[model samples]
Target: MAPIKNGRLLFNEVPTGYPIPGRTTVYDGSGTIDVESEPLNGSILVKTLVLSVDPYLRGKMRAPEAKSYNPPFALGEPLYSHGVGKVVRSEHANFKPGDYVYGSLLYAEYFVPKDVSYLQVLVRPEPSLPWSVYIGAAGMPGQTAYYGWKAYSKAKAGETVFVSTAAGPVGSMVVQLAKQDGCKVIASAGSDEKVKFAKEIGADVAFNYKTTNTEEVLAKEGPIDIYWDNVGGSTLDAVLGNVAPFARIIICGYISQYNGEEPYGIKNMRQVLTNRVAINGVLVFDHHARYEEEFYKVVPKKLATGEFKYSEDITRGLDKGGEAILEVQKGTNTAKKVIVVAND
Candidate 1:
């Protein structure tokens, strides 16, 4: 068999602020894969299909010594994210050729993993959906929303819930879940188009933070009982000022500070003590063992039935991986940003 060219996105240089395309990451098409003859050792050879472009990756673009939950990207090596791929060859008992899988995958068209401990064979509840959905809606982001809401947000009926970045994968799912639980949902997004999408997905009051006053809207709507803070910074300050007594605050992410020149300091943090708020930081990785099986069983059916709306802003080709992630870091993406390496 002929050797096939492999395309890869390498973490070139670590960035102080927002990562630059050619400077921080580079495309390397110099490698080739001989599918039939390449040594697999004990790893599976996967053909990357879809990769997620998430803001959390920005924290990973730092010095290796900087302590964090995830390891920093090794300079000159392929970047990785929660991705869906097809197993091309396997030397592991758990994987086999033609099996669809989901896990932390490299930013390459083809590669053999050094570790397969975290990989799982994808068994979709609704097999008709696109494989990219597994990386976005029914994958990490959705899992984050489900686990956080169920674990930290003890939202009751008639409570007011505010979700920032409501058009995003996590926030959007939060909006839908809150609405289903009989809460009055208020959602904020960066654009008017996103605001409309939030309303379409069941937000009772959707506002564009860029155009409208967040505090004003929350005041007019009601004191928020549950706040899903995705974009932190000014939004957190605003929500702090507007929360109801004993409000539950889920700190899933702080995307606004991920690439900002200076970190945002909350000015209304005193509201936390005043309202007796319960602030809980939820990391999806922590709850995966407890909730992932249920998430797969539940979310996919709602998504397939059109009862739950999930959107993906896709960029085709592995070469565009750098640009795709930059879109997510800048909050310029309308929905979940996903890079498609190949069609399944």
Candidate 2:
């Protein structure tokens, strides 16, 4: 294929209840994708390989004042999320041509990053793992799990740890990491198939939350010492009811409430006070200053030792991006759902 001097760009015009015409689209554009690109400043042109489709992106699509980790996605602009891309050109000294990097890039074949500071250079070229793994296990979700567990819960050996959305990118890593730390892990997913995959990855106990009563199933498993909460709403409430004395609950992502008209409320806040439990909300970007410090110390070491593992649900093309997003939100994808924008 010849060089893409100009290519199609996909953007979201408005939030929708489901995937529909006005919600997403592809259009043609031209001109240099410099850091000073109009509405998006500090942009850097990138040849995207894999675009990450995450539940968090849905939250970002809400109206501006919704108060998420970042501001809401601008109307009539390309939607952005964590992705792996090749730097085809660079106006920033930290990034150069031919460098394979991972960061927040637009959901397009190419991107001109506004704030390239979020972008990190990918050092491992001949990766023993697939490139998509970096976006899931070794990338953002991996960091989310690692720091959340270490900082908030401090999960230890022999403790009963329960993880919700346990088959997705962050939850899957949390299970393996907890196991590596000698914790007995109980995981909850949307389906029986994902429940099995959760076990295959290291979960001592896995349940299909869609079919089982989370409280009843967890009751048989005994009290949980640590709760890695990826799905909030009823799941969060259930975990609160079953938490052991002095337990730690790490609130990662509320995938359960992301698409809802109103956020889910927990009727069990009193449990935190009664059980002496520590419930902390985690945003990975808040710990950004220590990203390099933590990444080098934790991720690379475990990856080399074969202690960390990850999985992805790959969608074939940009046209399929909307489908991938829907799949993730509906809890259909077993792992990290990634849209392949450009393979080569």
- The candidate scoring highest on TM-score is 1
lDDT (C-alpha, whole model) for all candidates: 0.91, 0.76
lDDT tens readout by residue for model 2, 198-314: 988899889898788899977889598999888778888888888799999888887766665476788988988999999899988777576647665678557656767666788
Deviation in Å, model 1, residue 63 alpha carbon: 0.7
Query: Which 10-residue window of candidate 1 scores lowest in summed lDDT?
Result: 256-265
Error of 2 at 30 (Å): 11
| Candidate 1 error regions (>4 Å) | none
Tens-digit per-residue lDDT, 1-344, candidate 1: 99999999999998978899988999998899998888999899999999999889998898899899978999999999999999999999999999998999999999899999768999888987888888888999999999999999998999999999999999999999999999999999998888889999999999998889888998899798999998788889888988899999999999888874588889999988999999999999999889988999899999999999998899998888889989888878889999999988
